[model samples]
Target chain A: MPISLPPPSEEAEAENTLAAIGEFGLIDRVTAGRVQPATTLLGPGDDAAVVAASDGRVVACTDVLVAGVHFRLDWSAPDQIGRKAAAANLADIAAMGAVPTALLVGLACPADTPVETLAGLADGLWAEAGSVGAGVVGGDVASSPTLVLSVTALGSLDGREAVTRAGARPGDVVALAGRVGWAAAGWAVLARGFRSPVAVVAAHRVPEPPYAAGPQAAKAGATAMIDVSDGLLADLGHVSRASGARIDVRSGALEIPARLRDIGRALGVDPLHWLLTGGEDHALAATFPGSPPEGWTEIGVVTDGEPAVLVDGRPYAGGPAGWDHFVR
Target chain B: MPISLPPPSEEAEAENTLAAIGEFGLIDRVTAGRVQPATTLLGPGDDAAVVAASDGRVVACTDVLVAGVHFRLDWSAPDQIGRKAAAANLADIAAMGAVPTALLVGLACPADTPVETLAGLADGLWAEAGSVGAGVVGGDVASSPTLVLSVTALGSLDGREAVTRAGARPGDVVALAGRVGWAAAGWAVLARGFRSPVAVVAAHRVPEPPYAAGPQAAKAGATAMIDVSDGLLADLGHVSRASGARIDVRSGALEIPARLRDIGRALGVDPLHWLLTGGEDHALAATFPGSPPEGWTEIGVVTDGEPAVLVDGRPYAGGPAGWDHFVR
Candidate 1:
């Protein structure tokens, strides 16, 4: 139901596609004059980029987005695609209670793709990463039928113990920091072929994850943490199983934002369902043994029981809340 | 002339395709029982994997391989594809004279793909990484029409100065370690419906880069270094331009390996051209101030001239020996 939007404009300075510009030439254009943070010792044009591992440890993860499946060119701009890619990977680092340091991109596009499309994508990537003080260090470009972006993010733990999903205790209090249901509501709006809900439509393009909340949660003695990429209930279940605890979320306690409620009301759908099952919000949900930090709203509690997530005191049974990448 | 062999036997213990298995289940199957290296502080699961960076600096790079473009499943096994993906990125680290520590894979494949194929790919990735004392620390799996592997390699400099391609000076001796032209020869053999060169065929599948020679060069006071992925002249040209010096390679002085010569004779192809322009060799080429240490053979001399590559006093005028990913 995504609304038909104009495709990302292909504004090529030269009348040449990726094939005409060639790989090295395209790379030269894509990476020219990009300022890097101090952590980037050696930048692009080298065999490998050298980044300062300030604390002698590196946290790493990777994610990929395939054209048509993860995104439709008709719906998203090149810059939005790039920004989403960076945000998706950086959110993983934040979920680990680490500060993101650098990103390496692996991009594939058809030979006929406009060079400006790649530049716009780079602009989006750099803009999002720069917002969090990270820089793109190295990447590879290849030709393919569809556009696929593979991004790997590196982060530093800053000498603190990494807050993992397996550390949640029975007595821990579950808390959430960041928006939920917004991206899902946005998706619904876009899916319905309506562009009136502009904010929600933009949210569907770029998720604004609360980056600082993760480290703050770690410092606040959070026992377990996870980023809500695959819906709140689904992701919370991960913490439940990993930590061998039962998580009971109070649906009434969730602070449903007024905008999300308004969007759901306009669409005649239940916003609560979106709050529980909406994916890609990238909100931080953690279990704190004591009172949670500021900016985090207490939403649930951990208890001794079978490892599962319960909504309002019972195991909520419905369609799966997480995204299955392989399920069409 | 790819001989269509039957698809890699689908030995999925659970006869389930990627969709049936689901993303989390597929990830578990793909990563189960893989032994990790000491460098992997945290492996898989949770948010991000933590890799030990002993020297306080990390070298990182990423590369993507698309099906039918970078590799063909009909011709090469999944394991071989995984190995090549790991090798390609690891070679970049080796080019920087860094010791590889870990790899993160971002894989996208069709839903109908057999689970065994992914397992085989994982086997190849783990085996290749293990050979270099590295580990597959993390990965993401998604769905796409064509198979794409986005591999990111992380390495530790081990407190040594990174040997960059831009450090070559006039009068430095150029040396090479590892096989050249073998993989290209294998490709040629396969292209012509002739696969008699068994070793060459295997070489084409798995590039055996001189993993040790890179570190040895760094210890031996080498000035500049690069991996021979894009052919000798093409890669050397990178060094030339970066260092602002001309590289003159003596064709007669090159010790053409016997197997390469034999394959060239059988195919009626010039081994020299393959040696000069053949891509995917993954060999280490370096510049040294005086005579290089053991295990490296001097192949050329750096001289004061415009940044370019010369073979026996002439600029190579043949077609590009290096790969251009966008070229059809």
Candidate 2:
């Protein structure tokens, strides 16, 4: 809860919502002394922030998280939502084999939402971005009926070729880094009103993405790469179809982490289902022509055939399902 | 009304809302055949888009707009909303004295929102971005309770120093390019149910910012610049406060555009009031140490007396009248 709010000033603080202090004051509270990486030549309070480029190019990605759809206010705090939103955008940069440099946040919240909440969101944004040596460079705030966060991440390639989904080839080993199915398991635990094992609940709130492994995989000659944001099988399908190849996920090869297994045993659900179908984990799934670099676990292979993702040569049927905002 | 939806194909066209087609399906419909500008090395359908950076740095800005607050679906078409959203962000880039190169959009709409509406929105985005020689490089779509648009624009400094709000000094001439108070006038016309002068009504739906004059003024050695977003006095106050100088606007020297004057005459309101208080014009206001470049109209001068925006050597008395999202 220690978000390091600025020293109390004439501007009204947490007693009232953002409406009391107004937009400009809220912006000041959220952005005061927010740290920036070296890539940022300028930070907030400008028309635009100037960021250093790599290889004469910049990698940019954006994501929007709606309050009711992407997260529940009752279940998650402002810091958690902020971190998740930042992670989602950063994961895309990592998926592209790039290093994140800066983030521009666009936040829309109800007028009655607390200014402290906004400050906490900013704190979480800076915390998550700072962990990866990036900065929250610029931001915009507006009033809406509900909370809507749109985050744009800018990254640098560091003079390396970007790994795309279209590059997977036959005989390539498909590997993954970072934890899988933990966030999904966390969501399940939270949704069912079961709060035992606090880590599971926390995972659902904040996702820890493998940011560095992206550039490392590209360096290790990753043929195809994607951040597993929409289930392991679902996202791999994109790589498979784009590469015009078949990806086979060996079920035995996947090691379900202890927390996921604990939740599965308590709920009587298969942990593998969450591992394969639970999304929002944001782990790196890549296909390498040779050996994968350190911290990567080989879990599958790419083969020349129909563009399908098969688990142990069989197609995976989704479980109780994970988060999909649009589909009813 | 002619939104120019893509030709019907095997995919579900306007028959279904986003919920009916699912998220990936809706994405396919929305992104198909999206045009990319030449600066984009890669466009949508990837984890991230690679945009060409100029002078080893990229200028970035973001803005958030919510439905029913910033726009209304009943009053404006999807295309108009899309164009306005894109214009707002591009205007910020121009305020930085940079050339816009690419945009990343984040959209959150209700599940019941029609696919055709989304497509039309995409068309509007492309049309507006194309007019500026920029591309919609990438975007994220999600479901929310209401429509929310968060736009991030990336611009190129093009080897010129960014003309920030803090660069102005005493003895600089204050100049302006593009229209002022038009959008607010249009909003007033729309709110009052006046039907005459279709141009005013249309202006409320779409803002036309002078995108070219930003880089031109920078090339001509602009001291400070800002987009006239939150009224002339309010935004000018930002430049004045940041630059530690006073800006004096000579009302007799100002020429109220003919259309604004006609609207004011018909409505029996003082045109000067709207000229000073009305916002959302997105016109470029800059300070020039010497004579301003071509197409810029000199309207005021900077003074060393104080850090306040004065209308003919007196302070603006309009209290709590400008755009503040949180104040009801």
lDDT of 2 by residue, A117-147 (tens): 7887888888899989999999799988879
Model 1, span B1-328: residue lDDT tens: 9898776455543356887787888889978888888889989998899999988999999989899887888778989989999999889899898999999999988888887788889899998899999999998988888789999999988999999999999999999998888888888988898765788888888899998888889999999999998898989999999999999998887877798888788878888888898878699999999999898989999999899899888888666757888764
All candidates' lDDT scores? 0.89, 0.87
- Give RMSD to native, each candidate: 4.3, 3.9
Task: Supply the TM-score for candidate 1.
Answer: 0.95
Question: How good is the docking of model 1, by CAPRI class?
Answer: high
Error of 1 at A64 (Å): 0.8
Q: Note the residue pairs that clash in candidate 1.
A: A1-A191, A2-A190, A2-A191
* DockQ, every prediction: 0.81, 0.78
lDDT of 2 at A90: 94
Best by DockQ: 1
Interface C-alpha RMSD per candidate, 1 decimal: 0.9, 1.1
